[model samples]
Target chain A: MATSRGGAIGPALVLHLAVLAIVVVSEIIGLIRVPIGIGAVILLPILYAFALGIIFNPNVLKATGRVLNHDATKLAGTMITIAIMPFIARFGTTVGPQIEKIIAAGPALILQELGNLGTILIAFPVAVFLLRMGREAIGASYSIDREPNLALIADKYGLNSPEGAGAMGVYATGTLIGTFVFALMPPLVHGLGIFDVRALAMSCGVGSGSMLAACTGGLVAAVPDQKDLILALAAASNILTYATGLYAGLFLALPLTEWLYRTCAPADRASTMH
Target chain B: MNNEIAISDAPAEGRAIDLASHAVQLLVVCAVALVGNWVATNVSPLEALPGMACLYAMTIVGLVIAKYMPFYLPSVAWISLVAIIATIPGVPGAAFVNEAVGKLNFLAMATPALAYAGLALTKNEFAIARKSGWKIVIVAICVMFGTYIGSVVIADLVLRITG
Candidate 1:
């Protein structure tokens, strides 16, 4: 199956087969726990599945990778949108029977979206003066640079420009590594004992479904009793993020980061380049 | 008339395969998901079949609705709406839909979902990620951290005042 040279099996089927095999292995491994000094970190099957995927990619091992083909990656991106439907429905279905519970989360659901803007507040300056990046920092720092933002940036800057390059750069990196950071973040923050588990769970909605899943999975592992509420709030929070991330990134985040870039990049460049 | 305004990045070759083939592919995924739910969550595949089928049906029907709708609302939203209304309190069979879907762990579904996503992470994309160097990489981490932390803080405050 690995070395078969394009007899008849389509790349999409091959990709699904790879997912099926990985899912079996990953689920058997199940969730793992590691005791770091601060706390025990829970690693979900999804994390293992993600790692196995990276290794399975043609880049690491030519044998399995050859079956993936060039079109497979593009196909993977499209399928991702479809693949998460049940996942969405999984939590989305929770909304009705649990409507009262979700309703109680209403205000926090709306307010937490403002927190997404914190992406630029923290990343813009770091990308500019500290990192000595150019205006590309604008696109990179404004929002989490997921699909909607990618379209927003591409619409404004056309993906061929520096700003667009910055956006795509972060978008790609997020796809590669964001799941790990998101998965691990909940436990670390939970360890801090500052944020409520429900709040931490709600905040896990970072726009991308995989990132949201990894984050919510970490929290569910951390606080299993609260799993139902966590899933409800995370799903609702994600929907709000999807509906608003574009508008907020366009009207608020993009413009703000553009100004920040203008104020800092020129001075930072002059001193550093000199 | 509406197809030409396509926003989807679906393979142009698969253009003809959109609605029908998509449902078939989803069925295959639902099967894999059924197995994962069995292995990981101990939810019997026998027990999970109805809920799995329900989610599958809701998704394909939702996609069809999204395709035909006059305006452009996200299919995720439509799918979620379909699932919600179908299971909402007092609707016929709502109880069955609720109990059935609730059996299959959402996180179990997430493993395969992310796995599908992970399959797309190409070596070329990884190389291109390095083209901009580590600055954007670090910045990306900060951005993710910032949004997550920021949301937690705000949510913590609101939930506290309200809880």
Candidate 2:
């Protein structure tokens, strides 16, 4: 059933077409245009997908399970993987011409963007002390924003490890809400007028490229004069997140999380910990 | 020998037909994407075509490179790198490429991809989180919370230095 024969399409093909139709419908309904089209907006493509998926879910495991189990979805996941860079690349070109301006503004803006790592500091303690989550969950909950984090965790703790499940949970959560939440930060900060627009713009690049773009887009619309430099700083910071985030998270962030889990986890429960 | 060989070739012949159909299916998906873009932005389909072409073409090229890479370079990085090089200001077609591709919304493409992901999700997908109980949700919230706090602190510090 997974494969097609005699020039006929299969379930996978139907699934793809059905999904695309939903996308077209969502666009027509303007679900993506919520909260104004300015700085840090919520596009909600993932939300849309989840909603439609549940609605269309046949509830029959065999037929519906086919969509979940096929090799085609894996291929589609590959398609989405390739989609990330070009998505960022589009933003990259927009900022490429403005690199010199951002450089002249101040290199310190790059450091400001490192705040993305702050998640580990806070998430680890909260997960270990407040929530009493296991060590694996601590690493996962800290930074499950990207693919490499999943790989790193899985490599150290087998895919079936508690850490893997924890990673998957957080990854799903991040995929669902991380972009929207992160997208709102710049404008909110800008509205507070607590920081210079440049710092706010630079901070927008907390490593997730799309989130960076969304944050920067909001800032650009909010303060149009700073567009080029803001975008440039964000692009630079985001690229750095991809380049350095893996090692930083694995070496620096997760270790801190692990240490917190060890220190904060109660003595009775600590002995059982990984 | 001829009848036996013909019988053996049926599945292979069917596979070839399936492959061709699969390609058509991809093309149809692309068409839906373009049409959807036009409806959402009111950008003419003609204007959006070039950008869509570049996006898919580069993805194909990126896939090819990914197939050969010795290490684990993501396909997006490769596609993005090529797109960036192509659109640099001094390049011959930079302006055209930027304008054309810029017209197509990457978010639009993401819609279908996410929707497909949704269809694949059954209630069972949440079983792990359920077993983990409320702790997973707490971790998710804490992750976002910490990231926000971190962003604010970093932004504040950077502003202080620059100002």
Candidate 3:
């Protein structure tokens, strides 16, 4: 039975503790010189896949259903606006010549710096407003309660489901697929030589982010109640793994992959693709 | 007295959930995207682009989960944020976001708004599922992993053949 009590620690807290423990242990292990170069790149997708698998499992969905049902249309509109905002901001800038100079001086360096700043200038407020609007819309439709509708959704998606073949199997499969696709692009790009290894890596990495976002969104919608918690966990894990993976990809994976792609990819295949 | 109590309390409860969810969702989404962006940077050579891509991808994934599965936006956002933050850092800076200010900027300024917008635009839930489904997620993951493994294997093979 649920009680009306404040500061009550529950199973979720326990789980959070366990996850924290794992993170600490992993970091310690990482410090032991595990040849992080290659391992780091490979680890990102694997870890992310696993985390998301857990978070978006069925149990989470059951919880969300009990709390609320959001308006689908408003949510969709918000996503489109958010997606387009970056491009609009970038191209829409009035400082054309100054931007060109920065771009010309060092495309990657300048863009990286600008992008970071730009994301700040434009992205945050928009998201907050959208969320606020979404909640308002949801409120109009459903009764308010402490138990979040969002959490209920997490429960229903099998995110907190018992570990089984279905959850683990699917997650593993997805991770493998993501990793493989990421692995292939560098070589193909390297063969072209039109862009540096770093440039190719950047393109591929960005592409992966875009693809992952779309793919994750689709997965969340499709699985619904079967893997809510698993999905949530996996999503959480991806954030951690991807953080390292992104760095590794930028510094290590891209160069190594490019070298490999240039040397190993069949001359004919590389040539044909280029 | 009773009527006055009822009127005042009524609106508070009604608005409370909206306020709570909105606050939590905004914080969680922004935080996750910020952390995810940091992680993606570490994994790929692309620096910020990969991080951004991963953030976008996770957002999409979270949306999918929320739309179809029974998960809430806040929980998904938090879980995603924490997980990505945990896994991506091989070298502190490599996988992690460089400069606290940068991290703060992304989390504070960019993520919430974008997430809100993304969530808003999503529609045709049934169509999205029918069109993409589990197969697409599976395929996408496979392709990602395959590319990495294939690149390495092919590279090794080419070296051997040439030698």
1 against 3, candidate with superior lDDT: 1
Candidate 1 docking band: medium
Decide which is better by DockQ, 1 or 2: 1
Fraction of native A-B contacts kept, per candidate: 0.72, 0.43, 0.06
Model 3 lDDT, residue A26, Cα: 27
Ranking by TM-score: 1, 2, 3
Candidate 3: segments with Cα more than 4 A from true spot: A1-12, A31-102, A105-195, A205-274, B1-19, B25-99, B102-163
Worst 10 residues of 1 chain B by lDDT: B1-10
Task: State chain A's TM-score for model 3.
Answer: 0.26
Best by lDDT: 1
Q: Residue-wise lDDT of candidate 2 within A47-107, one digit each (tens)?
A: 4554575466554345655554454443343333333444555555555466566566555
Output the better candidate (1/2) by lDDT. Answer: 1
Give candidate 3's root-mean-square deviation (CA, Å).
Answer: 20.7
- Which pairs clash inside model 2? A39-A218, A40-A218
DockQ comparisons of all candidates to the true complex = 0.51, 0.25, 0.07
Worst 10 residues of 1 chain A by lDDT: A1-10
**What TM-score does candidate 2 get on C-alpha atoms?**
0.76
C-alpha lDDT values of all predictions: 0.79, 0.58, 0.29
